[model samples]
Target: MDRTAAPGQSHTTPSTALAYLNPRYWDERFSEEEQYEWFKDYSHFRHLIHSHLTPNCSVLELGCGNSQMCEELHKDGATDLTCIDLSHVAVDNMQRRLLSRGLKDIKVLQADMLELPFGDECFDLVIEKGTMDVLFVDSGDPWNPKPETISKVMATLKGVHRVLKANGIFISITFGQPHFRRPIFNAPDFSWSVEWTTFGETFHYFVYVLKKGQRSSYEDIPVKRFEVPHVNLLHEELESEDFAFLINVDELNC
Candidate 1:
């Protein structure tokens, strides 16, 4: 939980790459049973999810961690709840808590998010909290170099696109520049759209409530033609990477 960046290091990296993959890391952090500081104060996340969640609808949580908010969703009448976490210990803890409380029918998966082991169009709602930042911070993950900051963000959105039913909802909270707002409405895999925003605390958090609606009928929408001015700087860096152009941005020239 080293929260501060190293001196002279403008970028922040995850303290543990694949650390959650290790059961001990999760077991230690969650065993304390105190609510994580971030979750305790953020009711906006819960409100956003509740707005999109329907009674008896299928839901999936990406990077659920040890958050108990899923139970809250269930209490609000969410049916067919499934959660994915990279940590076995975290999943085990969730399962045990559900069982102890006599809860039933929640499915949990312990797998890496970059490669979700699930069928297509399976969920009606996919929710995430601050996961994009986590992906960028995981510098040592072998999945790929610390994702081009925004590349992993787009990939996560793509994953949501694949697993969501037509008209399914994707509710995510993101922290970054205003430019990220532009893509949620135009990404080709699904028709992206906005829902809301809140300039709260230290983060300019945007609540992007995307629906897995029909992609434009035009199949010839070329990816090469999509360009932002600073994309050229990333040509050499991300050229060899599989997920290119997922995150190209100007560094604000500050």
Candidate 2:
């Protein structure tokens, strides 16, 4: 939780405060030789993704940021894989890595998450890892999100909703709690089934599985029965000493 700059890292400034919102910032960050992982890798959550994925499932990863999750998916028999990021630099880097490894089937592109170029209902799965959390950092207030922050997040969700096939699954691995993220998935046009798992002991994170359409038998339920409403709440479910389970009834219908 240290916000101060490290020995070589740049100091925070007005421009740098919301750097994650800018493509140039990510380009510069990924241009460095050292790789950084925001949270756990695909190995930790491979079962969750694989359980919902078919061998030939079309997968899309939003804001991939040089992560190797797609490569793992490819090795695991997912053939139609695509990854998108706002930074061309990151995309190029990923392309080179994939190419060097002979992973030609996985496609990498530079695109904004809010305005995905893909047609409607094209993908069987859309996966996000730490992408929305970056938006929260860009908002300058993780707890009290600004209007623009919510707008950008909603736009990205809408785009994901449009691109996913009926019953397609969207899995997001994030540090955000259900209270902060559930409303974004509670759309009237689509019914959703959501479940979350907690990882790590002291510094925990959550993996949220959001399935489109009515609650299905394939979906996993980890928590006791509860409903998730659409209304925004201040400081709700923000503090936790031990890991907890929360569900959105509006989405889970359980």
TM-scores of all models?
A: 0.66, 0.76
Tens digit per residue, CA lDDT, model 2, 29-105: 67763234446567776776778778689999998876777888888888999999888888898899899989988
What lDDT does each candidate get? Answer: 0.57, 0.68
The C-alpha stretches of model 2 lying farther than 4 A from their native spots are: 1-17, 138-144, 215-254
Per-residue error (Å), model 1, residue 97: 1.2
Instruction: Tell me the number of clashing residue pairs for each predicted model.
Output: 1, 3
Model 1 lDDT per residue over 127-239, tens place: 77655545543333222234563476667677788888888988766543334444434555556454556535533456667666644545224323333344333333322
Q: Which stretches of candidate 1 lie over 4 Å from their true place?
A: 1-28, 31-42, 138-151, 199-204, 214-254
Tell me, by lDDT, which candidate is best.
Answer: 2
For every candidate in turn, the CA RMSD to the true structure comes to: 9.0, 8.4
> Residue 145, candidate 1: how far off, in angstroms?
11
Measured by TM-score, the strongest candidate is 2
